[model samples]
Target: MTATQDIMNSETLMGLLAGWGITPPLIEHPPLHSCEDADRLLLNRPGTRLKNLFLRDNYGRRHALLLTRSDKQVDLKALSRYVGWSRLGFASADRLRRYLGVEPGHVSMLALVNDREQEVELWLDQELQTGNDFHCHPLRNTATVLLSKTDLQAFTDHTGHTPLWLPVPAS
Candidate 1:
């Protein structure tokens, strides 16, 4: 069995947590190479886990860091209208890296710190707030951080980014 202790030593996830004075168990697994893998990983874990999506509107005038349930299907139209954007789509991995300073598989909210300019607007699903803890990448794919929702909010606030909480309609 891969122990949490083993995973905690990883440079990317653990290093970030240590920098933030935030300590959380590191869950190691087969590389979570995609959103589908992330969803499956969350199923076996006990707390709330999010699927982070990086997007830019068609005009390149707006950027967003969208947080949704691992299983929730995002409706870009609803997102665009709610955010008062005319059209929005996922940004390319290269664009995400250029803007957030994170690679394709490691795109995470934590990467916002690297984005000192705050180019991407942070958005969270209402459901995610209900949980005591939410798992997110610490700027890497090899591990994930399971920290309190309050901590995450505090981090966002400290970063000087206003997060938009949007509730998805019943499917």
Candidate 2:
């Protein structure tokens, strides 16, 4: 929330992507806050979608965006062990704004673009590496973007973010 930056919403996200020459197909729709909402809104356009979680470490010093398929369940203990974090828990709306610049039900990997401090690390499910039809909100829940993994990689690289690929098992 800087003076020059007027809230890192989808418009800002689109501009940033354009600067990087990354054009992700935008699918405009009603605001979708949950996986079920997304599933209902964007029917027949599913492949590898994401559920971005704004998380903090046990002590609340470290933060991360845990991006996994909307279907996969998480085991915090295993995830903590994998990432060497003592424990993992959801961060609050205030913390999300402080770090990733988004609110609850609006958590998306693209929000990482606003993390200029590089404080929120990106943790992605390894299964995402095997998909081409990737969809995610562009910092806003009202719209979604279907982009190639290469473009997503480019965006991540442009943001100086190298995701920690993890194996998120099903529950």
Best-matching candidate per lDDT:
2
Residue 17 in candidate 2, Cα distance off native in Å:
0.7
Per-candidate Cα lDDT values, in order, are 0.73, 0.81
User: With candidate 1 superimposed using the best TM-score fit, by how many Å does residue 169's alpha carbon deviate from the native?
Assistant: 4.5
RMSD of each: 6.9, 1.9
What is the C-alpha lDDT profile of model 2 across 44-126, one tens digit per residue?
Answer: 57557787878899999999898887887888778888788878888988998878777777878888888876888888898
Worst 10 residues of 1 by lDDT: 1-10
Model 1, range 39-156, lDDT digits (tens) per residue? 6665477677677889899887778898888778888888777777878788987777666777787766777766667788888888877776777777778777786876777777
Worst 10 residues of 2 by lDDT: 1-10
C-alpha-based local distance difference test score of model 1: 0.73
Tell me the TM-score of model 1. 0.82
